[model samples]
Target: MTSRPLRVMECAAGTPGFGAQTGLMAEQNKNIETWRRRLTFRSWHRGTKELDLLFGPFADARLADYDAPALAQYEDLLMAPDPDVYGWIVGFEPPDPAYDTLVLRDVIAFQRTRHA
Candidate 1:
């Protein structure tokens, strides 16, 4: 499939508050799966956040199985048309070691352009 720029908007950041760890893990996993779906040219928006959680580990596991072309295809998707897919990509403050919590830092709005 033709590559396009994706615009990722991180709506929120990971905090040390309640369910923060779980939430960060979920987000990380979900983001990974979202990457897989995007690379495979699947309609990610059609599914729910649960889909994101389910596909996260699956995508990570499949990474080692992907060939060079496939990996390149995935990277291409990240940089295409816009880096943000209606707020798919997110940013948070860095996790704090003292709190034993993951704090997403530098959560900002940005644009990434991918080439074929």
Candidate 2:
């Protein structure tokens, strides 16, 4: 961990350049343990119990492996209304095109296995 590397990381983190995603890179660079703790809390406390179950285990299992984009997707999912997300997981509705990613697809599969 040299100053040069730290400086480079800082520069990259500062360069997201957007209205919504400005901190995306810096957030991804945060300590994994901290992120896991926060994400776990969020997953377990969703307004609906069904969503809590669906996302809690899923986040616990996958949080360590998630890249920035995957985390962003999860955050976006959290921001969405729970009923719509439930419908997506249960296949009554498709995930929004923007949220259709491997992370979400895996959760959908997990939901099927749990129900089936």
Candidate 3:
């Protein structure tokens, strides 16, 4: 299946949309599934336990629904140093504002919010 840019309806982040966006995403299930598989592998095997824990679970819970812009943001995040990502996740350091995006914020929230 070919990927087109994700055309999410303009809803407030995390708010439920008017059904149009959800319907559109339902149509892209194949592409989203493909991305989810690749991201799951990468997230789980990031070469560092801290990062693996932080990202793997978040990816498991969220990757399947990520739109194109969110995926692009996540790809940008994957390029950061693991140590920096770990520091941000653990609260030892804040993420560099340049790389601190909404996607990253959502990941951090997921990490902190999920219970074992």
Candidate 4:
């Protein structure tokens, strides 16, 4: 079996300027490109399971802008546990102020496991 490294980014809406923020983050983080394929766009209106999985065990912030169906799909992706895939979701703060956006980024890296 192999282990993978993954990275995910979650962006909120109404943050003064969203596109710019994304661009800036992308520029600074070289790993962002590797995980772009696994990006998931979610809305606050959707379920929390997907968000929970991405955010890890300690994600308590509320989402204020998201679509229901989109979130469901995202949740499904997160629940998938494959040794070849490892990922995490970034979280936004001040949930109320942000609306019309919920970005979920995920990355997947693979490493072979050795047997004794």
lDDT of each: 0.38, 0.77, 0.81, 0.34
Instruction: Report the error of model 2 at residue 18, Å.
Output: 34
Q: Write the per-residue lDDT of candidate 2 for residues 42-106, one digit (tens) a residue.
A: 99999889899999988887787886667777778777888888998888988888777777798
Instruction: Score candidate 4 by lDDT.
Output: 0.34
- 92 in model 3: Cα distance from truth in Å? 1.1
lDDT of 3 at 49: 82
Kindly report which residue pairs in candidate 4 clash with one another. Answer: 4-109, 8-105, 43-66, 43-67, 44-65, 44-66
Summarize candidate 4's per-residue lDDT along 1-116 as a digit string, tens digits: 89665433333544556445476566745443323323333222225555335343222232222234544444554444422113232222222222222333321110111111
- Residue 115 shift from truth in candidate 3, angstroms: 4.6
Q: What TM-score, computed on C-alpha atoms, does each candidate reach?
A: 0.24, 0.68, 0.70, 0.24
- Angstrom error of the Cα, residue 19, model 3: value is 13
Q: For candidate 1, what is the lDDT?
A: 0.38
Find the candidate with the highest lDDT and give its number: 3
**Model 1 agreement with the true structure over 1-116: per-residue lDDT tens digits:** 99776523232234335444466677876766665556544323324453333223334445545544555544543343332322333322322333221111101111121111
Q: Please give the RMSD to the true structure for each candidate, in Å.
A: 20.4, 9.5, 9.2, 18.8
Question: What's model 4's lDDT at 114?
Answer: 12
